[model samples]
Target chain A: MTDTSDLRSPTPDPYLSMDLLRFTTAGSVDDGKSTLIGRLLYDSKSIFEDQLEAMETSSKARGDENVNLALLTDGLKAEREQGITIDVAYRYFATPRRKFIIADTPGHIQYTRNMVTGASTANLAILLIDARKGVIEQTCRHAFIADLLRIQHIVVCVNKMDLVDWSEEVYQNIVKSFREFSSRLQNIVEVTFIPASALIGDNIVDKSTNMPWYQGPTLLYHLESVYVGADENHVEARFPVQWVIRPHSDEWHDFRGFAGRVAGGVFKPGDEVQVMPSGFTSKIKAIYSMDEKLEEAFAPMSCTMTLEDEIDISRGDMIVKPNSPPEPSQDIEAMICWFSSGKTLSGRGKFLLRHTSKEVKAMVREVKYKVNINTLHKIEDDLEFKLNDIGRITLRTSAPINADAYKKNRITGSFILIDEHTNETVAAGMIL
Target chain B: MNYTITHLKQLESEAIYILRETAAQFEKPVMLFSGGKDSIVMAHLAKKAFWPAKVPFPLMHVDTGHNFPETMEYRDAFIKEMGAKLVIGSVQDAIDAGKIKEESGARASRNGLQTYVLLETLEEGGYDAAMGGGRRDEEKARAKERFFSHRNEFGEWDPKNQRPELWNVFNGRKHFGEHFRVFPLSNWTEMDVWQYIMAEEIPLPSLYFSHERDCIIRDGVIMAVTDCLELLPEDVPEKMTVRFRTIGDATCTGANLSTAATLEDIIAEVAAARQTERGTRADDKRSETAMEDRKKAGYF
Candidate 1:
């Protein structure tokens, strides 16, 4: 292909700055998830001396002959004793070509909400499959959730090749089965397969000597070279106001800038914009980034915008292009990932809805359907959604919310439901 | 003007956004300022979050009373410069009041006792949110924490029941008597903090840089010869060129032999170092699950 070796070289170039990638790992409890992460971190030299020492000592105390690299991520006492991840732990490391953020999520059925959390912002999802247990129920559940979350890229890491004796036939069989199943997904953009042994560090960060029949790039190579430039929302302009900056100083007494992060698309200084809720229209006069001003700002950059006209803008209000403004709706239909143990979400349940910078009271109007993750079937009769349950629900808000479909703009389309009495987050919802 | 955002700038924006959200969502939010590089950078970000508004909250320091004199001085000056209110919850006070008994022996430190004082202060202040400079890359236990970590009425964090933080949406909802610990720099690493401080020209305590200090060599670590550390017949004090990788109670925080004098020097040193910064914290070296144990007991 495209000289994968050259891409993995540690050459500092400015153009390679756009290659930043965020991915998540999901699999069953025994699918070698932690081993895969440990292999990636260790082979990439991301593990520190202290961390290695700690891992060695812990391994010795646990009566293991070799260093248990999985202990690297099993931080909690309960997690170590039970050998399961109870929460989503985020890890950060960088190769010369790109920076990476890995959301190590739990794979148990009870912790499915954590997976939803991890997959929400990820550009790619790496679903691990044990070679011995190819395409099990948990695999289907993880794949379906990946599809539901609209993850653009998926790298199926068939781990434990050592157990399968590095058989090419077994690898091809698993790949074929996964492909046939994934084809039924609604919007699966891409799915690539790689046979690896995470415990022995094969095909994770370097070329595997065992898998001679396979010719695909290593996991780290794929991560560094994957084209993620298109992951950002470049089609719609959305700016959710966080705070109003009024320097109120003698030098700039009249300077009023609306401070917020650019959530989607690009905004130039001369672009005509509309302020939500107030329905005020104006042109962007300036885009301030700490010390300097810019002509344009894009997704994920936090900056202050000074409009040509002084609009009644405040925190929780959204700024958008005048001609292509998102519709404000009080009634929203979304897929909800329940996260609270105190209450099961049902019809006419009052709670708080927190969208980007905005919190408004909302009520669940209807529970349309719940997906049985194992069977990949919709259970329309089941209306009650407890903790870690995912279902389609309609909600009515106290005030009209400016929004977009989650598939279109991840930054604007996501929301969390908060319990009124306990003030705990009860659910996570993604707009359809 | 042309405003180009480097990766560090993007991270700063994300941190500032989270800080603002905490301030807006919680009734009384306080920033935990430890006068270290991370907390100092966090204080600066807080200032930027509410320009001309005086940070919109007070800064609380759970003082172990065994802090470096330079760090205390730096904390006062920085707080004064920002025109923000400062509140100190002393572990010494807690010990004197018999609220928390000090640990005895060679490993005795006020590090664990600070948790009790911190929780008491949160209860007394009725603070619904407390912002910390904790970064996920610092330790494995920290890696599992949410940006908005919820604590019970007793200030206990149930790591198993954390809210799902998706996208940039942080859930800061908490009940009465309950508080949220907000970590704005969860994604930042030690190297990133140094680089940001260097680029932003953020001032730090002089203890972070190399200087000649009287220290005792114990278990291959330079222990600062402070009043809290009682010299043993076998332990001899020696003057050495040292700098702190992390700032904590003087009794437990160890110093490393280094000649990194400036921010740039520190950046270079960190880039070349193979050991993690927490390796220097004697508190974390107690056990494999030291951090997790402390976190479960409400140690921030």
Candidate 2:
């Protein structure tokens, strides 16, 4: 065996720790969404004895027959008492193959904000479809939201299959109809259809022998094996300097490096990079992962880089490839999901626009149109954007933010609008 | 970015990003080090975040006064080695100043008292951001926490109206006098932490390893017979091989009967262990909403 050693080597138990999948579950409350997640956690051996005991105790106290698995996710006291999920509750489960973080969200029109919040960080979204209800409005709404967030993998769990006798005809009909509707959604790379009964263990962890005609993998199997390596933007190079590291000590008097997680593309020691807002070009001298120097560094890695030239660079300044630089502009158009309770966008109204590492003053120049998520219809002339509203709007920023189209580079293209007075995050915007 | 990293490295990057966000977004920030494994790991990440520069923030410890001497020693050594400033908000001082009252009897502990001291310190220091080692996997209430948890002027958490965090961009903007409790270890599980510690070769207090300690079995949990503890008439100490899964207040933290002395042994035990690290503590057993209420009132 070739001996390879580095400052940061893989842990001894890499099998249990390497792969991680973050997914969100979405649907109407009665679609067995909670039960599906509960089954996954229960079967994956993620549930501890004390937690199960507490759930059983609560099940008894509530007179819930046969131990309601759905009760496992109701973490807050109000949620447990009111039987309504208020926000997204994250649950962790791991198998021998991979680890998973489940962002379980509430399903209600009023809780659309909650669903969007959960779906933002998910690589895959499990859209639970009630076998009886078929393709409902909530199903369409959830898929549209997931697609808007650019979640690549979509696992459509046609739950409550037992209610439909696990019939292949029903499963096929639902799958065919869903595919027809999902074709309209953009940026969803993969969609999986599985007939499962979350109430009883079926096609979740164990293959359901009842569905003899279904040859696809189980829900848990797909989650463990789904490919997520190419999810990040690898073409455009974007590195926003988060902090400048200058030791002000005698140990390394001239040591100066830019500390940041790579936003897009790959970077090497001799790569030519152009600093944003200042137009200073320099070659990267070295990359360091702590005390160890590396030949190359890439996206999402937390290594610091030093440049050949002593150019002035600070937080909010992006270092991009000189070959193709990010567009620096003061005016932009975007699709935003309004997260504020109050109607806060207007031509003259100002908000803090946080894009990449820079925060600038921005105002909505115009609200062009609002897309009705359920029907996927655009409603024009709706100039006012309210809470949980997804609409296309034009904005003017006080200063130029180096950015790209959201579809091209998510890290640089996406931003959030923060309120100036209350300091609450009011909206999530994607540059169009 | 065009890079693919291991899960441990991804976690480290995410944590370091959060620390940098806290430093860049806030006026004044402090990392809350409890002398626990999570805090130790967090401190280590902070060191790596801005390598060439001194850590942009100081560390604050809400000392309960009922801490194991080993933890105190470890905290001091860690501060010295890392060259991080330490701010100790003492619970004893809070009680002595008549700002809070002390509890008595078998259930007496400074675990809850640390909350008052912590809030007082945050207010006194005008700390705009307080980085904590609280992990979501530790408790039910904490599971819903954001990487940047915002608190009102009173430093209270509104579980109902938490800001939605998306991508790597965290919204840390807050009103004057309000601060955020940033949990860099929000996504980390206990197993992940132990695995990272072993991979990083981070040092921990001796209390984490199994050793001959005087302990007593109370309410089905092993309570270490430390000098900070107040024993009852029915409670008696016996020599037993024990190790603490977690370290907090001496009275509330429980030790497990084991001989898993090394880091690998602890990792295996944590993997096979049936209960959560917090499951053994008596503090969360107070009520169904014990942790929830404490969190709402700004408890770390």
Candidate 3:
């Protein structure tokens, strides 16, 4: 029998542990979001026999002459028939270097909310443009959404190079136009351009034999090589306590650890920390994982922390560095991505606002402006924010909230608005 | 001191953060524990999420009473070890009291019956939030699931009207009688889960590893011939060296041929496996969209 106690501290092999990469894919109906994902899975050897068999069966049933690469990601039957992505479909694959989560989002205007939801947490967004089309309105819309969501890295894959006879001028022109447009968006930090065909497997996973003009790394190579370490907030120490861990067992009876994942910065055992809302100060006693205690914990680590002094702390409460604390405010000015279809979000509508671990009643006080995604301009006259629309809004909450700017901290700076009557999520907002 | 977080660790942190959000936001919350690896991992994360302090909520298992014996044993011991409360809503009890009529046929399964017991358990416990180990990578319909999934009074999931989950902010707000099903492991894949389990060194039931068991071949699936499973003359019982890909009712949950004797070996096996774990599940084989249909009916 495997001893239960011995199972707690088994040594881990780091080489076998896979790294995760969260990315978003954007493409018009014909630009091949599904084909690119299918190609990635196919070439990376992530596609399974059953999935391929299912694809083959579905393709045959649909009376298609060839395997529909789009069928792999166009999950909904409606989407498969319509030849468009109606909603965001998340797909997972892994390479030796990194495990990937692709949020394949629709490129149309109606599904912009889905794009926003997909891009919000993504570190990188793969914006696909058909080489023949150059830069279209849909391309601009997707890029604008990626920028609005504060996605740092943008890989502009100029797809279907095979269709365009692998023209370098077309690729360069598209790249220049995307750069010019992206320069206007404040959130986009880095943009890389690659010319490839998702259908023929050119520069997707392997070097394209046809495209001798292209010298950049393959799409898979770029995805695996991109430095995502700077993606997280390492400037501020934010630990939102998920739960208070107090094992009543005899061995750990007196342990009072604050269980949470570190959202930003680095937290050491001896670092002085302040509990949010209550404003109580304490020093970290220990940072414990499942098997052992650690001297320090950094951003994106879920570990239990014990304070030197017994401070009253609970879930929704934050532990941060004393010197650089997040501003606690009841009035929040934010950019809201309206998602509900019931009614347009207007001023002074009561809703539930969830920030980090805390939820409180909030009312939208004012609509500052609505963003015209295609034009990249703000329309102030339109006070009504409808579904799939991005707008600026002011909110007043029932209680004070500890928050940072969405740019500074993705974890503490974001919130969602829930409809009180219907209890549906109405909007997603980022604190400005 | 420098702390480096692996990709799986980052995902775990995100999940723990969501779990904390559920506990903090909801008035009363409980975790859905099915004795599956995902649920086991979720429970482990929950324990780590609120370490030093007790997990703020109890664990609810909607027991169909047709589970693998090892699963029940593991569940009981694991709950006891974690010092977390475990609440079981028996489908057998529901059938005995006539709350739900037991299906009597070749296709009869208590799988659909567990949803009623689960919903009733949540209602009785006043649990406004129920944490589940659901992941988007599991099926096609689950691809669009929100981190905080809302359910109506009848516990039906309206896939058409899902809440938009942006960033790490989860909306767990619900009215009385309604509840939210929160999936912290939404971003995690099958390999990620196995790797995390291996990295964290979490204990699992022996059935997950290669074991000799008397199982019957029915409908191209190896169903464990337990007391809970009714066998017909057509079903041929045989002893095989097989391991369960997923643990559910002994009748529907299928086993895979494997030589994996250790956790590391199992992880390697899963990493190299060509098909998804759900490919072995007979319940999902009922239709092309069987999982979707069940999800719509509030079957977690």
Candidate 4:
């Protein structure tokens, strides 16, 4: 449990023991997603005096009736002038229980890439639904994308309670409709509902007094207490080698360590490991995190491992327990979300596929189908994969890729396709 | 702690992963070390990322010729201790070569001129990637920056056309003339940097700690009395206990009045600080889109 003994105090180090929560906010135009984020930052006292003063001046210049909280976001000059978020913007704040990183994304239907990019690393997602509109097509699209990204927890903020007269029946109805829509999403572990008024400061940082029928925690409270400890897969031991560390200096001339971030499970010094692609087995001599020799390392920990046997190993090799090895195949099937607007992904197209630390040239054998995110249906007739389109594809790689299903390991299961001619990242792929 | 990693540890690991990725992806990678706390943390993470092996790339500093004397001292000591190569891009050299002009007067600062020197240095070194310590929480414009920020041949940032960065999969692909500016500390906040500095026990310049210095209050900001800064007739210098929240050109970086001498004290002071760290940076005060304008022109 998080120690909130000194919840709001500045004594004895409140930051050392605190955990971190990274979440994404998704809502359509004027649904108050940015306003909700601004409220969270403002009410938490995260916005400094200078920032607030600047925001106030800008708000007045833009002829806003109130100090526009949404202006706190929309960083780029283009974004500010257009009054819309063109790309993903990251915002940071902290409470006594946790530090929060909010990936604030735009909600326009055309800006689906921004939403996907923001939802990629988030542990939780905040989908704001206008109390009047209830669950709309944009809400379903956001929910579907969040589910496709495998976000564990989602906090559905039914905002604009003030506009809806703080009606409990309205909030309940929206909750029911959202449940019916979200039941089709298979990957979300938890869905929580809260009534909020970002403009009126209700049920965001503090519990709303107007909505007394709601007994759930505030948005901030839910964000602080959400269980994301088990989000990383700790069952499969997978370590994709990122670099080969070797120093020729006299102090340590013979040290050859394999450096990588652990993707899954716990790895100890005496654990027997297998090198992927080569299938060579070796025993771990030691694990060193910087200068200290760690007894054990696990998922998400960056460490260097020295093997007892000096086998031919380099970057792009995976070190794992010999008993459970990932499927090594040249044929790959994955769900890809296209990102490039200048080019469209076509069948029989060839590109560079990067997964883990390995890079292989892959040719698309076929376009399986494109997903209609709002409807949650796969369209089989249209095979054209354009910008912001989520579809499945089969590809044959130049070399065998050792990968796990995206459901099992996010690190090893994810890949990106890069256009050979333009060198732009065309699509993000999830291994099936 | 229940076997879970602390936020600092997690941030450190993420940064290390990025540093490693930069080294593996780019042909000629260099770290833009500004002798600030953020850059210090990046260098330390780079060391940890490739243990036993020396940091693969050189450390480059665009010398504004108006830096704190303590910064240079610390920079030399740090590079020598790490046994890493050092590359200097001198703004003074650019001025001397008639490529850029040095601003004159009380408000004159080489802060804006460092961009030209930095770009020239990157081009001269043929570096395809330069790692920075830029954080999203520092400024408004920086909030939208990616971990792998691309630059055109002219070294300008196209914010609207930025590539989509997802998960931990960073796309470093670029054309021949294009290069990437990689920021490993993009997710960290100012408070996080201080906490990580405390946890790692990394050494910093004494300017960060409280010291007695002659300063003049200009527009509600405390500016350290430096030789490069031309004093106005109405300016009066007074000795006070002050510390620097950020280290930029001596002409532009402001000193905050504080008695926080130790890292613990600094952390506490930062927690209680109501002003953003960049509030002291006079360069950013020029306009609302100051950072954005400079960034679009390839400013670090």
Instruction: Order the candidate numbers by DockQ, best to worst.
Output: 4, 2, 3, 1
* Docking band of candidate 3: medium
Best by DockQ: 4
lDDT of 1: 0.84
Candidate 1 chain A lowest-lDDT run of ten: A1-10
Q: TM-score of each candidate?
A: 0.93, 0.97, 0.92, 0.97
Cα miss at B244, model 1 (Å)? 1.3
State, as a TM-score between 0 and 1, how close model 1 is to the true structure.
0.93
- The digit string of per-residue lDDT tens for model 3 on B126-159 reads 8898999989877777877888889998899987
**Residue B125's lDDT in candidate 2:** 91
Please, what are the lDDT tens digits per residue for candidate 3 over residues A189-308?
A: 888899999898899998999978888899999999888888788879999877676668798879877777788988888899999989999888888875468767877777888889
lDDT top scorer: 4
Q: What DockQ was computed for model 2?
A: 0.61
Worst lDDT 10-window in candidate 3 chain A: A1-10
Tens digits of per-residue lDDT for model 1 on A1-432?
A: 011222433653332232347899986557788778877777666799989988898888889798887777777788888767777888888766666889988888888988998998888999999999898888888889888888989999999999999999999999999988888887568888989998888999889999889999899999988876677777788999988877667877888888888888789999999999789899999987665677678877777888998778999999998777888999999988898887887788999999999889999888899889888789888788988888899999999999799888888888988888877778888988
Docking class of 4: medium
Residue A284 alpha-carbon offset, candidate 2, angstroms? 0.3
lDDT of predicted model 4: 0.90
lDDT of 4 by residue, A1-432 (tens): 133324434564667788888999976558887778888887777899999899899989999888777778889898789887888889999987799999988888798989999998999999999999888899999998898889989999999999989999999899899998888888999999999998888999888899889999999889989889899988789999999988988998899999999998889999999999899999999999988889889878899999999999999999999888999999999998999999887789999999999999999999999998879788999998999999899999999999899988888899999998988999999999
